[model samples]
Target: MAQVILTFFVAYGIVVGGALCGGIGAFLTHKPPLLSMELLADQLKIFGIVGALGGSFDSFLQIEKILIGNFSPVVKQLAMIVVAFLGAHIGTICVQWLVQVRS
Candidate 1:
C-alpha cells in the first residue's frame, strides 16, 4: 500500500523533472519563455495522465516481466518511471511540432 503510493510519487517526480529539463532545453535553444512554460506544463500533464493510466492497468507489468524476466517491485517501479518520463518528453516534442506547424 505504502509502496504503491511511493512508487507513484517517485514516478511523478521523475516525469516532472524530465519536463523541467525539456523546458530548460527549449529556453536555452531560444524558444520564447511562454512557449517553454507551456511545453513544461503540457509535458507534466501528459506524463501524469499516462502514468495514471499505466498504473491502473497491468500492461506495463507484463511488458516488464517479458523484458526483464523477473518480478522485482523496485525494478518495475523504476521501469515505469523511465517509461513515463520518456513518454512525457516525446509528447512534449510532438506538441512543439504541432505548434510549429500551426504557426
Candidate 2:
C-alpha cells in the first residue's frame, strides 16, 4: 500500500522534474521552453516508470517467482507498475497543459 503510493509519487516527480529541468535547459539554449518541456515529459515517462520500478531486473525476478507459483509479489509489482504508468501519464498531461496555458 505505502509502496504503491510512494512509487506513484516518485514516478510523477521524475517526469515533472525532468521536464522542468529540460525546459530550463531549452530556455538557456535559446529554444522554446514549453515545447522542450512537452517533449521531455514524453521522453521521461518510460524512464520514470522504469526508475519507479527500480529497474527491470527486479521485475524479471518477480516473473520468475510467478513461475514458481508465488503470485503475490508479482501482483503487487504489477500494481506498482500500473500506478507508475498512471503517474507518468498524468505528469505528461500536466506538462502539456502548462504548454497550452502558456501559449
Candidate 3:
C-alpha cells in the first residue's frame, strides 16, 4: 500500500519536475515555454514509469514469475505500474492546465 502510493508520487514528481525544467530550458533558449512543457510531459511519461519502478529489472522479474504460474506479485506489480502511469498522466494534465496550452 505504502509502496504503491510512493510509486505514484515518484512518477508524478518526475513528470512535473521534468516538464518544469524543460520549460525553463526552452525559455532560456527563446523558445515557447508552454509548448516545450507540453512536449516534455509527453516525452517523460515512460521515463517516469521506469524511474518509479526503480528500473526494469523488477518488472522483468515479475514477468518471469507470471510465466512460472505465480500471479500475485505480477498482479501487484501491474497495479503499481498502472497507478504510476495514472500519476504521470495526471501530472501532464496539471502542466497543461497551468500553461493553458490545451483545451
Give the winner by TM-score: 2
Listed in order, each prediction's TM-score against the native is: 0.40, 0.93, 0.91
- Backbone clash total for model 2 is 0
lDDT of each: 0.57, 0.89, 0.90
Scanning candidate 1 in windows of ten residues, the lowest lDDT window is 94-103
Name the lDDT of candidate 3.
Answer: 0.90
- lDDT by residue for model 3 over 1-103, one digit each (tens)? 9998999999999999999999999999999999999989989999998999999687768877877899999898889889989988898888888888854
> Can you tell me which runs of candidate 3 are displaced by over 4 Å?
none
TM-score of 3: 0.91
lDDT digits (tens) for residues 20-73 of candidate 2 = 999899999999898899999999999999898899688767877887899998
Backbone clashes in model 1, listed as residue pairs: none
Stretches of candidate 1 off by over 4 Å are 49-103
